[model samples]
Target: MPFKINTNLSALDAYNALARVNAQTNKAQLRLASQLRINSVADDTSGYRVGKELEGKVTLMKAAQGNIGAAKNTLSTAESALTNINDLLIQIKGKIAEANDPTKNLTALANDINALGDEISAIFTNTKFNDTALLSGSALPSSSNFVFQTGETEKTTINFGTMNTLDLASISSSGATSSNITSLSVSTLETAVQDSLGKIGNYVQRLDVKDDYLTSAITNATASVSRLFDADMAIEQLKATKGQIGQQVSTTMLAQLNFQPRSLLTLFQ
Candidate 1:
């Protein structure tokens, strides 16, 4: 090799190697400090995109879980009201049966029945969830469908049909007589209460299942995001150590190569 004082090719190569090592060391240090493998889109383009997608899905699932909880609470409130209504109907049925007896005061029994009916109507007016009437035959929010986002691209919904309202006061017993009590269709009211209870029970079960699914989906999605974005501290520490050693050695080698051109002065001596 011809010795050149003006330009040392060996020194230039060492400098380039040192720069590469320093860049690698900085990258490893950044990864360690941030605790993330892909801090930016430039770190891992495909991984970053996929991880962000998974993160979005996790966020959506968490929100859906909250919606499911609110829906469950709404259904629970409605169920409680329906249960009370059912109990009142049962009491009215008993009162009607008592009115069928000749010895019982028909006026008092009629008053009791009317009072129970009024209470049932009050329940319809008072039963609400989050200031929205749940059992008043009103159209439910979200277009009669209680829609909840269960996934990034999917949704679950419950339709509280218009058959929810019950006007028990309209079933009158104005004639205070055994014949009137027997003619009253209390069985129809019982059936309506049972049907409403069944619907609410079914909806509650569905919401519970959806809530469980969303919770599991969020867990899995979070894990997926972690795998794509989170850094392995052990691996990064090792890589950083190697990069530091490489940088130190390359810098030392560059210094030595720089002195090689100075050794050409010895030839002139």
Candidate 2:
């Protein structure tokens, strides 16, 4: 190396090396402070984009899980109401059969039937979850009538059957007249309730499977995002320590090189 007084070339080179060590040290420290590998898109452009997309999917799947829970709750409410109605129908049928006996009080049995019918009507009208009616006489029964968004890119529809117009509360006509059992058709009403129960059971099974899948998908997606964005503490700490050591060594070398030019003045002394 040629000695020069105008410019200390050796010092300049050392200074540049020091600057590089300082930059590397700062990058490691930043990662340590933030606890993230990719703090900005500049860190890893492709990783950042893909990680954000995965995070968005996780959000949507979480919402879909919530929807599945709500759908199950609604079905549960409907099932409860229908089960109670089925029980009442059973009681009414028994009362009608007893009315045929010679010893049974026909008028009293008819009153019992009316009271049971009223209870069933009350259940149908009052059944609800979150203020949305599950079973009411006015709902009108149909197949796959109610819709619920149960998953990402998926939907589930349920039946909300109504028994309001069945006239269960007034099965026995004119207070003293025969029940006119054929006109009321308690058996048919019971069958409809049973069918709703079966459908609800099936729907719940499907929901359970779907919920399990969402739970797993969410877990895996979150892990993937973490791998893309989260910092490794051990690796970052090692790098920071190495950079700090390099910075110290480079600074010492720069100071020595900067002092070398001053030796040239000794000739004048």
Best by lDDT: 2
Write candidate 2's Cα lDDT for 203-222 as tens digits.
99999999999999999999
The global C-alpha lDDT for each of the candidates, from Candidate 1 onward, is: 0.79, 0.81
Candidates in order, TM-scores: namely 0.91, 0.89
Candidate 1, pairs of clashing residues? none
* CA shift of 146, model 1, Å: 3.3
